[model samples]
Target: MNLSEQHRDRTDIPNADWESHMRRLRPILDLLKEKDRTLGEWYLKGETAQEALQHRAYDGKAPAKTAIEALSKEYGRKNKDDPKTVGIWNGIRSDQIGASLSLEIDGGEIFPKSLEISLNEKNERRGSRLGDYRSVAEVLSEVVRTYDSFYVTYGPFFYYTNKVFDDRPGVSWMLYLPHVLTSSEVPEARALIPVTRDGKQQGTIIVSVTDEVFDVNNRTHVKAANDIEIRLADQDLLPRYIDL
Candidate 1:
């Protein structure tokens, strides 16, 4: 999650350096590549999935730097003001992996600087590839480290479960708050994973009730996530989440 300040600095005025924006985006692509080989490849954009796969900026397995530079130049030329979105995936039509990176410019929308990376829920192989909670946490933590995120959370796809989250806005397998909250502050400190940088604890990462990939269909997993949300709400920590 890139902060608004970062976006403001990057997308402000005639001096908006799209090349710098692309440079900053390099780490995210790199991180995705490290997680799964199929991630961070094809540049997808179109009205439909099949059409999106056909949209390409460069050919072959070019280095990220080269691809990003080319994409930056394209965005600089064509999509100056529109909200730009690009999906990422391996080029293979069969057994394809899906992920996306999107940026909302300074339009009338709230959270204009939002950068969303989500799995393609419709993909059958998603469960085998990115269905684990720990794997998801590692990916999210890297992003939190990369940019100034107000807060971050990850949960199973809603349809994967029968549980309903009516009390609060949502529940998740993990929650990232950009502040230090200890065991004393949050009795379940065992779940809190510290996000540190430069030898200092930058924020707190709260995992789900268990260490396993959260199976939303499992009553235990759903209950666990619900319980954590209630506990955090009771502690008034739920309101502390930055709404962005």
Candidate 2:
């Protein structure tokens, strides 16, 4: 039959009507208390599931001081070292949502032999001359560690990158920030290059923390580091993910 006729006929047939069809399937959506084994263990054992979840959710603002006491009642203190408990704790940490930067640095110079000469039989030679060197290497390294410490307190750090894409852009690193902050607040990434006594390239080097470019799911991960590259086209790059 025609489309309209087919629809009309189906409605007329009560058993075939959409309402009746849905009614038969409504029980599937009912909120039944399925025995969630995970929850059961926590509740029955009087474990710290609720407290742990709360702490993780609120960044350890209020911890469950009595969780171990309650959990010990059922699982006992020995079982507190159980893998299941550890897994639960890790899961809580993973669920903590926050933003962070992947900071990295590179560049700097390496020197080989400084001066090698022999004074014999009325022969004299001069040593190697000093070259231009960036004086900010030590200061920059300290800055990177400082920023890294600040972020680690809030969440875990991750590194990522792709060599193929990076070659075209030359040597570069990035710092990713969370959406909670604005780009203007985070300046362009920068570092002071160090010069070695031996002849070697010396300048502000870009260091990257992201070793692997692809994610576990094989998807290309993007970060604020990429944005920093875009923002700072050709200026004296400053630290990108700084608070000030």
Best by TM-score: 1
Note the residue pairs that clash in candidate 2. 104-207, 105-206, 105-207, 106-205, 106-206, 106-207, 107-205, 111-198, 159-210, 160-210
Alpha-carbon local distance difference test for all models: 0.55, 0.23
Residue-level error in angstroms, candidate 2, position 171? 5.6
Model 1, range 119-233, lDDT digits (tens) per residue?
Answer: 5444432353554556656666776776666666666556224323443333456777767978677664337788888889888777665455555666776766666666767
- Name the top lDDT candidate: 1
For residue 145, give model 2's deviation from the true position in Å. Answer: 24
TM-score of predicted structure 2? 0.17
Writing each residue's lDDT as its tens digit, candidate 2 over 56-152 gives 2111222233443343343443332232221122221222211111111111112110100111111101110110112112322222222222111
- Tell me the TM-score of each prediction against the true structure: 0.69, 0.17
